[model samples]
Target: MWYRLGQWMLRVILRVYHRAEVQGLDRVPRQGPFLLVGNHISYLDPFYIAAQLPQRISFMAKAESFSHPFTQWFLRKVDAFPVRREEADVRAMRSALARLRNDQVVGLFPEGRRREAEPPTELKGGASYLALRAQVPVIPVWIEGTDRALPRKGRWIRPAKVRIYFGEPIQKIPAGKNREDQERIHQMIMSAFRQLAEQKVAE
Candidate 1:
């Protein structure tokens, strides 16, 4: 119940302070394993998404964030596992795969780092790799206004409106051992991001 309480508290804070709005939550699978793939903008991105979803998502976070004792403890408690960006972290991948095999949701930001101005054209391969390995549905989530709510380097949180869009899942990646399939999946994710952004614009 620490997780439930935290989710409730975060939802309250986000709704009241940022006027956060979430769309397409019904698109999320009610049960079973799935991968949540999204762009990283601000430090608050994970928190914003996590606050809205009832299914607890085990997010893959950067290893550096786990360096601090308090942060490590908190992240562990929240079921977040650290990833070493500089290399192919087999351990982290194993942990993620194990979780997915257990029919748990795994959250990942394929961009590898927070981007401010431009849309992500390139993404790390880990996301696609995991998708291929787990053979699970890939949910594309688009988060907007988070950068304004909490800028990349800004210390203070601003009262900017936040919106999250969840797109339909992409399933069935062709079996392959080469990088071609991974690239295809990556392109699919990029296309989904574009569509979600257009959705936000049309609104």
Candidate 2:
């Protein structure tokens, strides 16, 4: 299938060019309907994560990426769906949840958008909300050196060492929780991600 072929190509490319160094992959749930929450630093962050992961992971990409016909086709083929980020984008949420319910891995960048700087930035609450709604555990992943390899808005990709650290999944949000609890869940998710990102930088 096209998907399998693409994945294979990605694996080969990453292996040769990036020489991806992944750690703590065992922390990722072997089988899941799990949320992959991580910091987004470069355009290739999603693809880098996907290359290391064995599961079929889908990312919630920005709507603009899908504007071009060829780009849209490729994104869908690679399990990426566009989300109108200006607003709540309920349609995108539904599609993501449906995939999770079917026991698929869903990748999310808590920042909601890519950053141009070095250190990871503050995260949005969407990742927490998705985990809570889907009733699935959130696996916090921290990727390093991606920006150096493919800097933000840079056309040329320089071969660089990249590392992916997978931390244990956070507790799922309780059912029937009140609004206040939901906010707490969001804060907890962000805090956990912050810690993970910091640790990755320290290593």
lDDT of each: 0.89, 0.81
Clash count in backbone of candidate 2: 0
TM-score of 1: 0.95
TM-score per candidate, in order?
A: 0.95, 0.91
Please estimate how well model 1 matches the true structure, expressed as its whole-model Cα lDDT. Answer: 0.89
Worst 10 residues of 2 by lDDT: 116-125
Q: What is the C-alpha RMSD of each candidate to the true structure, in Å?
A: 1.3, 1.8
* Residue-wise C-alpha lDDT for candidate 2, range 1-203, written one tens digit per residue: 77767778877877888897788888888786898887787888898888777788999999999999999998988989989888888898899999999999998887778775344446666776777788888888888778898887689988988888887678757775566666777777767767776776677
Off by over 4 Å in 2: 116-121
User: Per-residue lDDT for 1-203 in model 1, tens only?
Assistant: 99999899989888899888888999999899999999899888887898788799999999999999999999999999999999999999999999999999999999998986346788888888888888888999999888998887789989999888999889877578568888888888889988998888788
